[model samples]
Target: MKHLTETEIADWVTGLHTPAILRHVEDCPECRERARTLASALQLFRESAREWADNRTPPVRMIPARRPKPWAVRWAVPAVALALLVSVPVYDSYRRDRQARAETALAARQAAEEAEDAALLSQVDTGVSRAVPAPLEPLVSLVSWNSGSWNASAGQ
Candidate 1:
């Protein structure tokens, strides 16, 4: 049988022993002695640590949590109500100011759009009022066909 490794010995201390470990430890005297020595050393260390904690460490005092004063609790609701009452008129004033600014912005935008529409209509009216386009005026004098000689209704 193979002897338990240093890690296996540690695992035994931590209660991680398998059936194989049990059988080996029972059968192997050398391994059993080694396990006992390691266990004894750990127990001594644990005892010393507990002794140090008990003797050397300072005691901790837990301070109780502070409660709110009765007067503060009594006035809390009225204070909140007063705050809400004061805030209502201020909030309404802010809302009206914002609405007025938005209305002004909308009116300005509408006036600009009306001006643009009027300018476009004036340009269209100028174009429509002309008898012929300026570019086509030069071509009009070149035509020899008189209006009385030709008719669109007859092919001739």
Candidate 2:
């Protein structure tokens, strides 16, 4: 007679085995070992599920949705804009001063970089000029020429 397999034994453990399969396992050592393995696995699964349940947090409910007050909105926008307008000129002046300082700092940095570049270029023995063109020179010259012409016309 063929002995019951592990699957048949697990079905027996779960009370789902056929009567013929149960009878076969009752006489088999291999089937008994399989049944014991299934029982241990089931116990481990139960312990893990219990631990998960113990550690899990229930979700939060009940958040009140906030609505803005009309008066607050009416005052807040213009007040903020007016504050911005008054402070912006001062801020812009401060920013312009900061920008001037930053430009001066950047110019110093660029001068140092150019000096290094020039030193490196000198070391390479390539007589090519790699210096970038100054963009502000033409505009300054144009303004000076217009002012001179206006002054000459004014004297006439």
Candidate 3:
């Protein structure tokens, strides 16, 4: 009978026995020794492989980079809108104030003009009327008044 191969011997040691190769290894001393040596080598290789697996570090998982949310842009829109809303009322108030000031100035100017007209009328009526003489004739002459005075003095 032919002796078992190393593959057959290894398989037999691991509980995968073939009957014909088993019969060969049972009768052949050289085949039996080869099977024993292969079994020992397989055991040593498995132990070292386990040790190497235990000592090895796992690969690190890299996290993907993330971008932050644009809160500034979100807030900026609301802030601008609020500013416009607040300014609208303030601008309206300022416009109203300006209009009121203009009306007040116009009223003051009209009042001043009316007062000046009243003062001119008063000056014309009082000063000009009082300065002009009314139409009248003189009662006595200088020569007649002097002759009467001389006669009275002579009689006295």
Task: Please report the candidate that would top lDDT against the real structure.
Answer: 1
- Give one digit per residue, the lDDT tens place, for model 3 in 1-156: 677776788767775576877787788899889988888998898778767766778733345544435697569889999999999999999999999999999999999999999999998787667623333213122123353353333334
lDDT for model 3 comes to 0.74
Residues 1-156, model 1: lDDT tens digits: 689999888767666677788788889999999999999999999777667666754833335545667699789999999999999999999999999999999999999999999999999999999877989877656654566673433333
Q: How does each model score on lDDT?
A: 0.82, 0.73, 0.74
Question: Between prediction 1 and prediction 2, which has the larger lDDT?
Answer: 1
Global CA lDDT computed for model 2: 0.73
**Tens digits of per-residue lDDT for model 2 on 40-84?**
999898778767766768633334535566588679989999998
> TM-score for model 2?
0.33
RMSD of 3: 33.1
Model 1 CA RMSD to the hidden true structure, in angstroms: 19.7
TM-score of each: 0.48, 0.33, 0.39
Error of 2 at 83 (Å): 82
Task: List the candidate 2 regions with Cα displacement exceeding 4 Å.
Answer: 59-156
Return whichever of 1 and 3 wins on lDDT. Answer: 1
